[model samples]
Target: MSGCMSSSDESDVSACNHEDQGDASPMEIPADDLATSDEDEEASNPPPTKKQKTLESKKPKTPSQIKKSTVKVGGKCSSTNCSKKALQGGHCFEHGGGYKCSEEGCTKQAKVRGKCVPHSGGNRCTQPDCTKLARLKGLCIAHGGANVCSFQNCTKTVQSKGKCIDHGGGKKCSKRGCHNQVVSDKLCFEHGGGN
Candidate 1:
């Protein structure tokens, strides 16, 4: 018991020595080495800035602006303009609500006794008695035929003034005492028709 008491005292003396050594000041550090000052800290990492968003500029719109858009239909024209319609490859009589030449791709409309500004590939004659494609030529054979001569089957060259008679560049045809070149109301001499 006396030896145990001496060893315990020795251990307590070593613990006291350790406590005294702990009293020494901790290792000194320079003040400059510590993190301080917003600017000095920010030198390593800058603060983020707010980003601005961009937008595209556009023109303002109105009802009139929208109405200006062209439409394909609505309106009509008079008979005088009929020929003009024909030359524009012919049009329905109404002609898109009185808007002449307003067809989507056409530039010509009714003008001067069935005339329109000429365009390529669109002149077709639609005269009542004629059916030929109305082009640079004004009239077709049947209309031209009747205008030049009054008699039926008048196979005569058109004279100085579109006449068909002995005095007008062509000799009258005399087929078996017939009065006209073609069969006609002007009958043969036997029928008492020719004067």
Candidate 2:
């Protein structure tokens, strides 16, 4: 025959002239050539069935797509004794590594609206006549956001060990014969302690 052959006989007998016959039935393809041609045809054309489309979509992504989908995990800040994650520079916000206040001559880290808390930035306390920054539930630390001193008749915030700074709960100066609170470098300001 001039065209490809299609048979429904019991014996394995088939002939397909793919070059001459542009539109031949898949059943006319020889058994040996079907495996390779089937894969190539599927890859070149979109899947016809919904199940086939879903299966095709589940294939592994290309290298470029994989790179775009990956998330970059941040490392710890490089500042001394700081355990927070690094943001912009090598240090944490408290160690002068984040966005600084936009106001001139201000070096404090910006918490909201590109300005520090003292410069009318960040969420304010919900309590009346209180302008301090909110710590929890829109309330400042002084307004029940934090724990108070355990000492009797004391309303100050707890500094350390359930006690306020006045109750000797804060870090003290490292110098001999000094009981003052540490300002920097484990020493009081009076002992030339400034960062």
- Per-prediction RMSD in angstroms? 34.3, 16.6
> Where is model 2 more than 4 Å wrong at Cα?
1-100, 103-113, 118-121
What is candidate 1's CA lDDT for residue 82? 40
Clashing pairs in 1: 74-96, 74-97, 75-94, 75-96, 75-97, 76-94, 76-98, 124-134, 125-134
Candidate 1: stretches off by over 4 Å: 1-123, 126-130, 133-136, 142-161, 165-169, 174-177, 182-195
TM-score of 2: 0.38
For candidate 2, give the lDDT: 0.63
Q: Lowest-lDDT window of 10 residues in candidate 2?
A: 64-73
Summarize candidate 1's per-residue lDDT along 17-43 as a digit string, tens digits: 545556533354445556465558889
- For residues 1-195, write the lDDT of model 2, one tens digit per residue: 333345454232333433454567544766678898888988999657998755633333222222221211134455466555544444455544456666777766666777778994678899999998998789999888778889999998877999887787898889988876775578764674542
lDDT of each: 0.38, 0.63
Model 1 worst lDDT run, 10 consecutive residues: 52-61
